[model samples]
Target: MALAGQPNVGKSTVFNLLTGLSQHVGNWPGKTVERKEGTYSHNGISVDIVDLPGTYSLTANSAEEVIARDHIIKERPDVVVAVIDASSMERNLYLVAELLSLQTPVIVAVNMMDVADQQGLKIEPEVLEAALGVPVVPMTATNNRGIRELVEAVDELTRDEATYEPKRPEIREDHRAVLEELEHLVAAHVPQPYPSDWVSLKLLEGDDEIMRMMEDRLPQETWEQVHEILKEHEDAVLAVASGRYDWVGRMTRAALVRPGVGQITLTERLDRWATHPLWGLLVLAGILGLVFLLTYSLGAPLQGLLETYVIEASARLAASALAGGPSWLTSLIVDGIIGGAGMVVTFIPILIIFFAMMGLLEDVGYMSRAGYVMDRFMHLMGLHGKSFLPLFLGFGCSVPAVMGTRVIDSRAGRLLTTMLVPLVPCTARMVVLAFITPIFFGAAAPLVAWSLVGLNLLVLAVAGVVINRIAFGGERAAFIMELPLYHKPNWQTIGILIWQRSLAFFKRAGTVILVVSVVLWGLSALPTGDIETSFLAGAGRLLAPLGALMGLSWQMMVALLTSFVAKENAIASLGVLYGAGSEAGLAETLPTIMSPAAALSFLVVQMLFIPCVATVVSIFNETKSWRWTLFNVLFLLLVSFGIGILVYQVANVVS
Candidate 1:
């Protein structure tokens, strides 16, 4: 079975519900398109489901459309379930009309019936079934309504026991004559499993891929005749489209009942303010402020408890256990392994809170509005509005942000967005900012933190404008996104999302951070059993002259260097340098070694520094160019240092 729909039609929700925990995601063969497949047991039989890309139509104008069209045509799924939005049936029916032309078994799953009902709209499923001549299952996939009926319809269709033979749309009378004539000419040479009439229609529509294929397959005379017919009826393409809309209009009149005049919906009421240029930004700012306030207020205490009771105690216990062990082994275990892992574990609470809040925003459908609000501003930077999503994801992590560039269709837009993603201060950097802000500024910590975040955004916008002007010179892709209606968030979905994200973070802690921590510890512990004389200190001292320009000491320089491995490691390295037992310990020790000027400058540099190793690897994977990857690294290095120097010098004079 295959699931197909336009954006925001709950196709993904249906896939997740059916597949549960059995789904696997990978790239489609020889394409960058994501392929999702899963298995579910239905009545003692295992059923396979493929979730195709969400495309508005099967026209081969975009990569997603081409992939979806080819898959349904070649793979020949048992049943094609067209998921339609009940509230916007008129627009969604366009895709259904195209699906019907394929002459395959299709079960119309009228999704979001609850949403339609909320808007005072009535849909007659039985009337629709009569009009379309196919099984119609009304459902609210989010609430799991009518899922069983949908599945049973699929099962019956796959078993060849379906009751209805779907009524396919007919072209206009004049276009139908040309299509019939062309069909007769190409019927013998038409490819197997593809209907000759469909081929004829596509040829008339001037589909480049189909025209090329027919030219290669048919004899010269037949090819020329087909071409002549297409040339004569070149305007028949509009007629074909108009015919589909006509059929859709007739079906809708028979089945759909519109709400009374002057009826206002909840989505409409909210959109008045939520999408306003100025008020929307204010609302967005307030929402983000509240989310961060909650995150800090809730996460800080748990973080403290974890560090004090769980991590510190565990470290003391491990050190005692290794009392009789070799000295190097003991240091490696207590300092390298336990210390590194403990730092990562302490961040779980903060990350969980962040993920939960983001998931809630997404599930409730406000995030899409956020993208919409930023679309105009994004155009000024030569990017589509959809590019905001990946940048928004950067607030959580850059690895996924870089990967999220797949959502941008244009190559230049994706590349430009990828280059700017690293400038967004991720949660790891936030951890550093959260830790050091209060230590240096006391009552002004919140303001300082806010400023740093604002600064990151400012830098991102400026960098985007500069990069766009220098490297890219083309019209920005138009942003066309459907804002999903606001709904109450499903707690189960939010829990699953947080769990998956947290699990991925823990895996990274174990693999990348673990190895980097062990190596850094070796560099600090080897050759002299003293950090001052060890190779790590020597390296920092070599860079100390450069660090001095920014008022950063050798220790601060080493901490900054460790951040390239992972931003959280900056805090862990500070704890090691100061011999602090916990984050609090390091906080108390920071003020003694640096002034407000140097501390602020250090924070600035960390905010603008190169992305972590994981993110760098993701950049390489997405861009497939070491040249761009190295450019991002070198570019950030220069920007960070230049900003650091300016901040440090200005602060010195003011002080």
Candidate 2:
């Protein structure tokens, strides 16, 4: 079945419920232009469902609309489950009317009924079904309510047992000749009792896609008449514009029933406090604070345990290998491989903590509220309210954040938003941020990390304003976003999600970071077998002069350079430079790296530079251009260095 509906009308949610799948659950899919299908069994009959991209109309003026329309006409599904939000009945019916023009068998699922009931909005399913000449089933896809009824309804409609009788309302008398031919000639070809007036209505809308579909099939004379008919209709959009709204009004007027003085529901009362600016900010802050507290503190102990065990195991394994292997081979296998693996493995704690917190917020629905709070600001940033999901994901990693751009409807908005995503100090930033800044700042790590995040945001805001002025160059636009009603997070879901994210962390540890770490270790190991004398050290000293521009010593410069490849390497490189397990000589080892200003500068540089390989790949995927990718890398690097230099120079000059 083709899942057709307006944007954010619970289409994806229904897809998730019916197919037992979750696909970012946004209104749109990302850059990949393809239709996705899933199959399931219902009432002992195998049912296949196609989740088409959401579209407001089938006029084919826009690329997305063309894609949505082409799929429905070309790859005809057994049934068209026209999912509609019960609350937004008037606006949604336009697409239903368009679908009916194709004479496709439709099963209207009035989804999000739970939400509608809570909002005190009631819909007459029978009256709606009769008006549209289709069966309507009131559904709550979340609780899986009325799903069976919807499926059965679709089954009966597509079986051809329940024939569709077109209800074409009155049309102007002048348009009758061409419309009459569409009814007779087109009807002979289409072989369905498709409405004469609805087809005529489409002709008036100047729907090129439908026109093109019928173009080559009909005779040459029919094509001539079709053009004449379109010309006669003159402004079809204007004609359909008048007709659709009036039709909607009539349908709802007859069918809709409203209760007088309906009491305020739970959602309305809670919405008062929830949407309050001050209280909402506080609530958001408190929730974020709890997330912060949990990420490091909860993950720290687990990290320590993992580190200790790995270190001991490596020591034992290295000593045991010395009996059989060559010295350098032993060193490569033992110190390089084991040490590299250990560092990333230790991050498992952080990963679990991060994903668990994110999943709870998203699964419980506060993520939507966070977006709600940020929406007005995002509009000013030239992005839609929906842009927050990707930005929020950016806090963890830029890959998913950039991937999240699929939900955005406008390419300009998506490109700008994707460009800005990397600038945010993600959780990957946290690995480097938490490790080094704490050396001098101590309890101020969170404060400094947050400050780096603030700086990123400040840059993003300034960049947005400038980009909007130059690149976007238009009036502010708004999005239709429904912040789902909040509920307490589920532990079982959170647990599974925590494991899901932790698995990703382990995969990185085993593959990406592990290989990079070994390479880093090898880079530090080669060229006279001395870090200060290695090729990297020569590269480090080149950076040291520029590092002095940021008030950093040679050692800190070396670490920062390594960080360009990956942020976590900044920490591991420092661990190598200062001697990881040498608390006995803390003063001698640590003080040599540089002063507080340099340390802070180092953190700033690492935080703002290009994200991991995954993020860069994502940028490439979204932009589909290498020039933009280079600009992102270099732009962020420039931002990092400029901020670092100015910060250190100011601090030094002040002192």
Candidate 3:
């Protein structure tokens, strides 16, 4: 069985409810699109389920569409569950129309019935199932309603005794003959597992993937003959779409009852301010400020407790346990491994709060409004408005930000957005700022932190404008997105999201942070267990001249270098370099060694520096070109240092 739906139709929520923690997530083979697979078992029946990418249609215009259609055709899941928004059934049915034409068994899952009810819309699932000649199950996935029924529906369809014959859509009267003629011509040549009639429709629709596949497989004369029909009837694609909409119209008229005129919905009342040109910006700002305030107020204290009790106590216990071991072994376990990675591990509390807040906003359907509000400003940078959604994801993490670019249909727009995402000051960078800003600026920490975030976005905007002109010739793509109706957020869904993201962070601490810390400690302990006379000291001094221009000491320079491993490692590396017994010890030591001017410059550079290794790898994977990847790294390096020097020199003049 497979789950498929348009974007924001509660498909993923349903998947989460069914699979829970028993899901495997990874990329599609040789593609950046994510794939999620899980097993469902109930009543002595077991089934494998796949969650396909959210796409508006099955046309081969985007990688997502190709992946979705190919999976249904090639892999051929036993049951294809089509999840649709009950409130927007007319628009959602277009994909179902395409799916029915594929000769597969489809179960229509009418999700978000609660949202439909709130809007005063009523849909009869029985009428819909009868009209479409398929099973229809009404559901509110977020509320955990109708899930068992949906599962039961799936079970019934998969049984050997079960049978279904769906009413599929067809081309217009004038083009039906042409479709049949094409189908006849390719009847024998149509590849295995691909229905000849469906291939014929795609050929008339000028589907690029199908055209190329047929062009290679068909004889020259047959190809030219097929091409002539397509050339003569160029509007056949429109005819096919009109037919699908005609089918959808019939289904809607039979089952959907619209609200009375002048009836205002909750989404409508809220969008008046949420999507406003001016007020929306204020609302977005206030919301962001609230998120940060929550992070500092709630996450910070929890982080401190973890640091004080868990990390510090663990270090002491480890040191005591290894007391009789070799001196080098003791230092390696306690300082190298625990000291470095443990500091980053303490960031879990802060990351959880931040992730939970983001998940809540997204689940409640505000993210689309946020994107709509930013569309105008995004256009100024030659970006499609939809690019804001993925760029916004950068606030949580860059990996998803990069992956989220798949939502953008335009190639140039997606690439440009990917490049800009690294500058978004993700939670890791925010965590570093949260830790350092208070120690440096005291009561003005919040103000300084806000200013640094503003600075990163400002630089990102300037870079986008310049790069758009030089590389992309300032070509802008039009934005089109469907804003999901606002609904009550589900805490279970939000908790699961936080758990997944927080688990990823913990995995990083165990792998990347652990390796870097151990290696740095080894470098600091070699030839003698004294950090001052060890390998790291010689390396830090090598960059002394460059450090002088930015008021950064050699230790600060080394910390910045280690940050490329992981942004959180900057603090951990400092602890290792300073030999701070605890986070408080490092905080107290940092101010005495560096002046306020130097501290400010270091923070500036840290915020603007090249992203960590994982983000770099994601960029390379997405772009598939070492040239662009190297360009991004070098561009950020120059910008970070140039601004760092300017800030340091100007601060000195003012002080």
Q: Which candidate achieves the best TM-score against the true structure?
A: 1
Cα lDDT, all candidates? 0.87, 0.72, 0.87
Better of 1 and 3 by lDDT: 3
Tens-place lDDT digits, model 3, residues 574-647: 88678896679999999998888898999999999999776787788788989889999999999999999999
By lDDT, rank the candidates, best first.
3, 1, 2
State, as a TM-score between 0 and 1, how close model 2 is to the true structure: 0.64
Candidate 2 residue-wise lDDT at 242:
59
Off by over 4 Å in 2: 1-202, 205-238, 250-255, 259-264, 272-282, 319-324, 397-415, 431-450, 464-478, 482-495, 565-568, 578-593, 612-626
> TM-scores across all candidates?
0.65, 0.64, 0.62
As a TM-score, model 3 comes out at 0.62
Error of 1 at 307 (Å): 1.5
Clashing pairs in 2: 30-406, 204-236
Total backbone collisions for each predicted model: 0, 2, 0
Best by lDDT: 3
Q: Candidate 1: where are CA atoms >4 Å away?
A: 1-203, 206-257, 399-414, 434-446, 571-595, 617-625, 653-655
